[model samples]
Target: MRALPLSSGSVLIDLHTSWNSANEIPISTTLAYFSSSFRQTRRGRKGIASSSTPLSSSSSFHSNSSSIRKPSDRFSNGSLVSSSTPLLSLSTSRELELFLELVPLRMRNELLKHDELRTLIEVVIDLGRKPIARFPTGDWVISDETVKLEDLHHAISKVGEFSDDNRSGIDHSLHRISAIRNRKMQIIGLTCRFGRAISGNAEMIRDLVEGGGSILVIGRPGVGKTTLIREMARMLADDHLRRVVIVDTSNEIGGDGDIPHSGIGRARRMQVPNVNLQHNVMIEAVENHMPETIIIDEIGTELEALAASTIAQRGVQLVGTAHGMTIDNIIKNPSLQILVGGIESVTLGDEEARKRKVQKTILERKGPPAFTCAIEMISKTEYRVHHRLDATVDAILAGKLPRFEVRRVEEKANDSVTTIVEPEKHSLHESEVTEKEYNTTQIEPTEDFIEYPVRRMIKRSNTKPSSTRTLPVCVYTYKILEADLLQVAEVMGLENDLNVTDDIGTADVILASSSELKQNRWIRSVAKFHKLSIFVIKVI
Candidate 1:
């Protein structure tokens, strides 16, 4: 490879087939070909454009070089970024070939007939049933012949030993094979899931990965949770240059073998012999390996949740996935509840209860959450982000709506991936706010128990001047300086929205100290008559 001048966008390439001897990347050779071909193809093109037909994985397994992923360009939070280098899918053809071997010969040929072979999600082979090949669009019957004991035994022999978790994987590949045992403990069914370590899928949350916070990922099965984190581990290890360790319980993260797969890049992998002892391995990964980040999959059970909290306390960034549709599911689960701050009933004092305007005994967050942020994988390309798990969980416990961002990941024709974060809506259907509410920069003041969005907590800015103006919120301040009130509004940049008036009758809200509100019964009566909200400040 040779460099080109800054004026010319493309680099002059002299390609050769070679592998990195250090075992740094299992698919280094493929990366070399992909990088060179991509640059050569763009030498004279005016602009990359999109066609109606999405040819992504439409033709063959390695449809184009875009499937051969490389580390994406650096990006920041709260904005969109793209890359010239194409992102990767399963790097090598051998991954698919090895997985196909597990299927019987008759079924294997039928699977090859499909045009979108790249979209192959998994294959279900059950005893006395036709082998079914599932894709994102739908499922296909591979053959008319029913699967027998021989076909099951053939798949078992090709993969590594099924651990206590009943899941095995092909050596040096990310493909996973899970067994369904009979009453006598004989293998009756197999679910062969072809895992792809797509590098750029995790790019949407790269900011969180680098933020050094323990993040718990929750989603329904088959939403690409494991695949997303596999690349995240690689990104942290190779791009951010951090020490990352994967506690692979089912041998799915690092693949199966003493030699871990290169899909995780330079990150090391620790194999858990038994699923029951996964927590011990998680702890050992932190203590023995001295890693800055630890990645775990299927973090269920109380012990695993406790281990995650312990690792988080020890100052290790953990990226793990659990069983749930959303963060609310995890909070409601008895065993996995601790991962998000556990809920405990608290009996508030009479004064305190009145202050919050809630019942005397109510549910409250028990302690600080182990994970700082929780993400819901809504789909392969969309994610619902709870930027602060503690605040989100608190709001949920208080029976208030939690703040979240719905991000859609799109790949542009220019070979750049863009992450667009939508404001304050979990989904398009969940959005009840009007266009004005969605774009409002300032917090709309509300009283307790009022359903107000929390987007202002994350992003606050000055509003551009509009032709129309609403009535200013009249604030009657008691036992406080009027200048101080004006100054505070100015500091928050909400002066335009504030009206500091001395008249109590015209006030929408009363700003008073705790001491003054108790003594001034007249002010309280005036506020009550006008249906005004009182915001109390602590007395010094």
Candidate 2:
């Protein structure tokens, strides 16, 4: 096969004469065919070639009349190829050619010639069964030939060995080939999935990515979470010049090789040796690499979530994707809940309950979220952004639907357009508790809600009114020795006034040992919401 560049920035791929005739094809053509197919396929699309001309003879190679247009640009105006078939102009089929190379030669040519290769999602090959091609539009085409053990072995030999996850990927390519093994661990089936590195996929959330806050992207499988993350890593490293590191667990983000793919730009990648040890690698990236930002994909474990929080607390920005459709889903998952500040049951005082008009025992955020912002990928082109993670979670816990901004990317006049639909302010009702709840209770004659007590505490003592004197400060100590705390309080002549308590709700201050505070995030968050004074005690 030979590739020739055209004036229109496209390339023309001329398949070898042997490929034209099944009888003349050689077994050695398998590997070369896979390599050349992807190289030419990417060039055809990225170069924007209007046509791909198959050259049979030397004379016909130079003949313009023999060229066939790619047919993709012609369908750019949203015209259907047939009444039932819609054109997939936005889809990339470079990986499809690589997948096609793995099937038997006779069946491969037939499947390749299909008009809907661009929309092909996966190819299923099983022993004694006909090879099946699947498309995103729910279309399936079965091959005439049955898949044999030899065909499966030939395909496996071309790719890297399958990992413990039963997944293998093409080197320097996004295509993934997963194995289905029998009871004896013999490969019985293969699922060839096409993975595309889509550029500009992160444009919908570009602003949030560039804002420098930790962002957690949530979506169902195959919704382009990894694709968007690849783009974000590239944009941040190349455009913004940030020191970005990707914790590539399965080589999915950076492709399947020791050398990272160019799709990630200048971003550094740390490959995890095992899927189970992904959390350790995440922490390693922070301590050893000193990256300004860390990008992790599919944070599904409790340890990984805790590691993510640890990285965020150290002031390194985190860009991660998780297995969930929305923020609420992650909150409900015990193992992954730490990513969004694990949920906890807070027992509100009778006064606090009556004021908010909720039950005494209510679900509350455990701590400040590891991620400051969350994005729900509704579809490949649509996203629901919870710009403020804390407020959104709080609202959800209060039995109120949190308002989210909708961002959509649409193709208009051949240009990608991003439209942000903000929720109408008027549409948001007052949170379940209203001013009427507070009004119903009679206020004590001498007591008043002194808002901004912290600010008042900073003022000169003489400027404060005698009647509004500060009360004894109750303290909750975590990991700090209670005896040491009392000794210090006594030395400062405030032991009677600074009493330590076990109840978080009754405490006026929380004196947490820094080491213990890192593990118990819920305690820190409860103190924050209660507006209690927090003092971190570091022990040598």
Candidate 3:
């Protein structure tokens, strides 16, 4: 491509050549003459073009130029301001190509230094009115060669100048912004070896998409979890047109300030400015925006898990990452457990015997056999099979699988249930009980087990409430009725130093008093949050 300045005036004409060859040299000389005639008829600061030939011919190279209208001229119409955008037009793709080269490298670095590069980039991309192209590695690629600087400047101006009331403009730009390199063919032509993405404790990207599996990816640092997630989003969104909305917490997926420097397909995304409101943004997207799927980076808190569950409840699929090396580590976490379904113990069997037995057992059970495929972790590059036997044993012990299978896997069933039992209690000293509370000792033996109700009182104080500190004694009074709450006391066993209550606001896990127990929603909310160990006393 070459730009020719007309001799008679300031008019410039751009010529584009699809093929690069020596024969195109004559066309460049011919383009210079065309530029002169285009400039001769114009007067004052305005410039016009008179084409010797229209652009509809099958010439070796085609020439096109707009009437050279100055920025002030375009902006000066009868209304005091003109509607013509002074920014570079998308009339020719090559103008975008030249404008990107004008961006100073130093300005780009200054942008990268912002504390919230991700959110800034989201804003920039939202303002960029061009479609993006997807590469196989899952990062978005912009040729910079194909984008005009004027268009980019307008987008950057929009992002940097936004105010609270103009947030609607931001939203509008974000929905239209894309994060992929737009092309008719793959930018990189190498075949993707996909079996390895599981090393970081993730299933294959293809499996998650095809099976509609909502994945919770976990990995130790430096394990390529982010890389996998980027590629996964791009493939699913560009290839399948799955409506994937990502909450890029750190901008690692797309990079700094508006145009996605990384490829993530054509998916639309929201970048949370600070990490504080991530859990909240995800919930809002699911509730208000009709997203088919939601993706978040590094789930960090209990509140996030609660929000993810709410989205899943609405049937919107979720994909997120966390820090861990194994499935067991995730399951053991109170916050992580909410988003993740448990992985049954996996024991790989030899193909010949295992396949035969699996086929026979699946036929006999008469229900769809549980997933028994081998699961591989991407970080360690190791493999293990999720077997029918292990799943059956897990289900049977949990009252999900039937009794007939329980008998077949006696040892396995016993081992699995051992992981679920409540811990044993140590003896409490009698001196711990105060003189005024010594008479309140109650014990009962039901057919299945024993229950204990004991009371202790030692001190009185006025202190600010703490969620981390479990209360030793609780009493409920409502509608002038009193109920003993020894079970709540045992569950919130501050004496044992375990984090028992789920509330982040209060130390005491008190149920509603008789006056409030009639409010069924209030009662259930308390019980669910506290997870008390035994029966809740009822008083009238």
Candidate 4:
């Protein structure tokens, strides 16, 4: 017999003619031996079952290993077990069984024996085509049996009726079943997706959740955005004792049923009657329920964005997920721009432009952002968090890369650990206060540049002259228009004292265009280390 390793930690045995003839072992006896071998190898053993049919018949068996064991036995038996081990680990075994019950008996038995059922993601069924099972690693044909009309109908009848979105789910389960229909409104194809309630997925941001501020999570499809949101709601409602309400649209967050899944803890759920009315439901959740915090999934519309802002303005914290990968995606999206503070272009006057040394036109944030923090999920276990959304957006608009913290979760056999990584030192930009310092520097006007009326007014004021002496300011321009600076000095009547230099080490102030500042981050680091005032001007 040859043994093949499966991804689920199970082994597949193939009985060959040589072993069958040489050992003359009965099929039943061989099956028992293999089952017992699996039990001894795996810890917290559950049950092991096997079947023995002809190799060509495509018969197989499956073993389910329990994750529980008595504390005394675990330690006395000389096995490595700890009190911190996860007790109820996530698995799709129950969902897979429910789905397999709808398939043909022969094909179902063949598929049930495969070890991949634990990691099954979805099942695809079409008329006159063989059914296929999809897993994270890859996909494979479940059986050689082709699906027929009766098979499709049997699957449909087993689940709830398809809704307007052509999607349905099993009762009290996270598994979603969607249908593709013909012109006559007859179901022709089906896709069954298995969902699991995974715990500890939101540990990376537990601090952010506990801090109580509006947070927006963004990621691509299937990156577990909804799962994280569900976990966050549960943590806040159950652990922190916060009044949380979930605006569940399509029944994805709370699950599919009148009663929500226990994964959401004590949080109450408000189901949207229609996808288009999600925004209305969001408002209703705030005004009618009076929740301290609102948890929403997939904020994708203009009205929903506005509603999010309104909820934040009311001083109610929001924990929600949206459609995008990064803050840049939110800024580029027209309908969703308001969530991150919409962008607008403004033309600066010639004098103002020369003071900053940049183009006349530039982009600026329109208003306060609805979300105070934004999290970008790089993967299931990794995230990039922007704690200061307003500052981050302003930095990005100024053509400088925003500083963000990287957080990742590392899972071990006993427990999971979270780590936060700070951005590189070179990526840091000078504070806005530092720029304001340089803006405060006084420059007395020259007699040749000052208007006669202004000179007369200054002379008539009888203002007492200060003892402090004005110092000559040497400015260094990098990627900043030299002509703009000269024009600025000429208008201010300080052309003689306001000297623009190329060497940064000899200058007191370093000025650069915003676009150049973002591209050249090293310059900012050098200026910061030397305690030099650096100013960034936005360019068109």
Candidate 5:
């Protein structure tokens, strides 16, 4: 690199490439090439742009430098301030000052709704005795002019008095302000446990932040989905350093007075109260605000989703919360389906579709058109992500929705480990039996009648004499069904009752355990038709 001086514009080249005959290239081309190359490099290396220009193999070293300077440029050092570390050594108070300065004027009244001056101090304050926090070279300081505390309080008081009319709106603005403060201070990231942040929809957030995809959290009212979204926002802002902004429609993200109640480690955050300008905001954030990520809470209306989709098309990262549980719930919402493009209906073959069933009662009762997506859940803590797994709706109709589980292991003493089981089962339809197959008869048992009868012979004297008829004594055993096994097992405790076969219409007694009962499904049918009483034991 070499230096040059020109009045209007100037170009300089590095002659170290060993070729002196090369014509000078336009500075704009060099800058454009640098920008384009930097982007490619940044993408390849996790967004860290580095110049990979090859050095010339020549021996001669010649460089050129240029500067188009004005007379006042005598003091200019041409140093560029790097934004790589925005919060480095930045004090809390300093951040607060910069925030106050950057906020749009129209919303300032709402953001500063709390502090007010007392009546006693208004008389002594001069016109210039006002407090303002300023930042020069990104370092914050209060103005040098001496001012009474009452003067500053008066300004705060004015905003507070004006905000009482729209207390709710003002409060929301304050929360938005607070959120920005914490992001600047890096507070929320300084707190919280890993894997303990979300419930019922944790995977959705994880996928959005880590899966290189976008996400929307939707559920019925009181499911606390938005709260989960806020925690995610905090996680991203505090931990990821990914620029996040909340287009808070209901003032939920930003708490009272432009302050976010929960800190999301966002470098920049803006709140628009009762905003009808969502598309404008999204465009502004990307075009002017330079946000890498954006978050909006409760995208309830059709217009909001439309604007959100537009924002998505611009290649900015988005995370949002909506209301609904199933994809049908989402489509029925009208606004959401239109915004994200409604979930596609699945088609299936007759043999494959026969096994499918609706899992939710709400969806079953008032089902909407089908949508293409997957559903997963490992624990109550989170639900799994759903997406189009196959090419056609028929695949989904075939009950081919992808299911996944997260395994957790617990360790005991001596490093003994036990795995917690998370079973993922497919949604299936149950076959119904007809009424003609049901048995309506119930035979009453006589008093003292035993379910299993066995006669124990007690011999008075060990005599084997007297008209003893020699006959073959045959022993028979029958297996019982699961239902009958449990019923008979409840009557016998700590032992299998094999001695009660006399009245059972059998010479031998046999009691079956649950395991045996399952293997013998014909026991109930056999017992019912043959009028035989069987006692079955249950195995644990």
Candidate 6:
């Protein structure tokens, strides 16, 4: 098999020849070209492609003298900005061919020839099951042939040695191959993940990087966290001229081999010989190299979190990622909570507790967090930014939700990227709070006559708010029947948390009709004085 690059801006892949043991390929071996579905964005950009008959996977790669890596462009901070983003550091899937080259020729030519796989994410192969291909849209059964020992051997031979973590990769490419072992400790499966370096992806948070404060990014796995930090390292090293060092574990961030990939630009990389020694290497990066910025891919350990705090104390900007959908995840995680400020239950004095309008004991920040700012990645195009970690943590402890600032990004087919910074909102809607708060499985049905209250501090319960258990809330209902609301709470399994209180002084929240609330000026004044949340209900 040979790749023929034609002058008409298309490459013809010659699959007619035998790729396995010199045997003539079957009649299905036909020439493949870039399909119309294959979108070619710009001269330097990479585009996803598919064929009528799958040649495993195909991509559109175009390059020219103008398509060189340039400094990433950032949109000016605003409510909305449609500024056309310039061609950032050029990216291409030219190296993707290396991943394709690893497939056992027999499997590639015969097995994956008919299925259409686009926007490829990963490929899974198990010993007894048929090989499966996964992409962003969905998954597909790429081959009828069950993975055999010979096929696994073909892959293991082509890649780097699998580490203690059961992960290996191509020396220069971003493709990672991870192994699965049975109870006997024998390899039985392999998951191959394709990695790409996206330029200008971090441009949305340019101001955060320039602030010179430690920033911790929290998100679910495979949300492009590694790719984001790779660009950040490059921007800090090549664009801003800051000394940046990356603690690349498993070669996911910097690729494999002694030499790091160009994706990180001039930033120096310290490869961890072993995953367990990552924390030690993190400290070593600061004590020895004197880097201005240290980029860590995943801070999954308490020791690593401690190391991060130590790094922050030394005045080095720390940019790292941890596994979590929200900063609250980091706050609740015993090991990772230290990354944000550690939580402590403090018993307040009589006057202090009464003045705060709460029980004697409450959760408080132990100290300044390692990271000054935390970013919750909603998606590649959207992000929830928490500028002040200390303030955000304090608000959560006080049973008040912190304000949210969101950033939205949209890329045009014409190669221009647009970014919009939505206006910040301090209050969350009733439905938003119901779905998001406390991991409660049941939602109180919205009623026209009754307004559902958000999470409020219940004076009855002393236990801390947790995802597993609900925090009881004290509600002082004026004119609205307490029995009706109490019945609703019982059905939703919030009976223990929801209680009716006659004394307005002890209530965390007030529920009353709009007409009644107007008649009772004293109640309104007291609620304002206590800074309590008010829910308006209508007469049934």
Top model by lDDT, which number? 1
At residue 59, candidate 6 shows an lDDT of 21
lDDT by residue (tens digit), candidate 2, 1-540: 445566655455443222322122323444344544334434333222222322122233223444543434322112112111212321232244344555555555556556676667778889888888877676465676688889888778767888988988876567778899999999999988877777677876778988999999999987888988999999999989999999998888987878776678889999888899999999999899989999999998899999999999999999999988888898789998888778887887999867754446667777889998998998887888878887777765654456677777766666555454443332333323233321222211111122233223223212523454465667787777789767766765565566778876677667665556555544533444455656665543
Across 235-347, the per-residue lDDT of candidate 1 in tens digits comes to 99999999999999888889888888888888998988889999999999988999999999999989999999899989888899998997778889999888986878678
**In model 1, which runs have C-alpha deviations exceeding 4 angstroms?**
1-90, 412-540
For all the candidates, what are their Cα RMSDs to the real structure?
16.2, 18.0, 21.8, 15.4, 21.8, 14.1
Best by TM-score: 6
The residue-by-residue lDDT of candidate 5 on 118-219, one tens digit each, is 100101122244233211222121334544444334333322221211222222122121111133532121000011122223333454465534556556
TM-score versus the correct structure, for each prediction: 0.65, 0.63, 0.33, 0.63, 0.35, 0.66
- Worst 10-residue stretch by lDDT in candidate 2? 438-447
The sequence of per-residue lDDT tens digits that candidate 6 reaches over residues 401-492 is 56557877876678666665653554543312222432211112121232433333222233445574345668888888888777766665
Model 3 stretches with alpha carbons more than 4 Å out = 1-204, 341-376, 380-540
lDDT of 3: 0.39
Count of residue pairs whose backbone atoms collide, per candidate: 3, 0, 25, 0, 51, 1
The C-alpha local distance difference test score for the whole of candidate 5 amounts to 0.38
lDDT by candidate, in order shown? 0.70, 0.68, 0.39, 0.69, 0.38, 0.68
Tens-digit lDDT track for model 4 on 362-404? 6778888998899999888778888888877876666445667
Q: Write the per-residue lDDT of candidate 3 for residues 475-507, one digit (tens) a residue.
A: 332232222233443444433332233332332
- Give candidate 3's TM-score: 0.33
Point out where model 6 deviates above 4 Å: 1-91, 110-118, 413-540
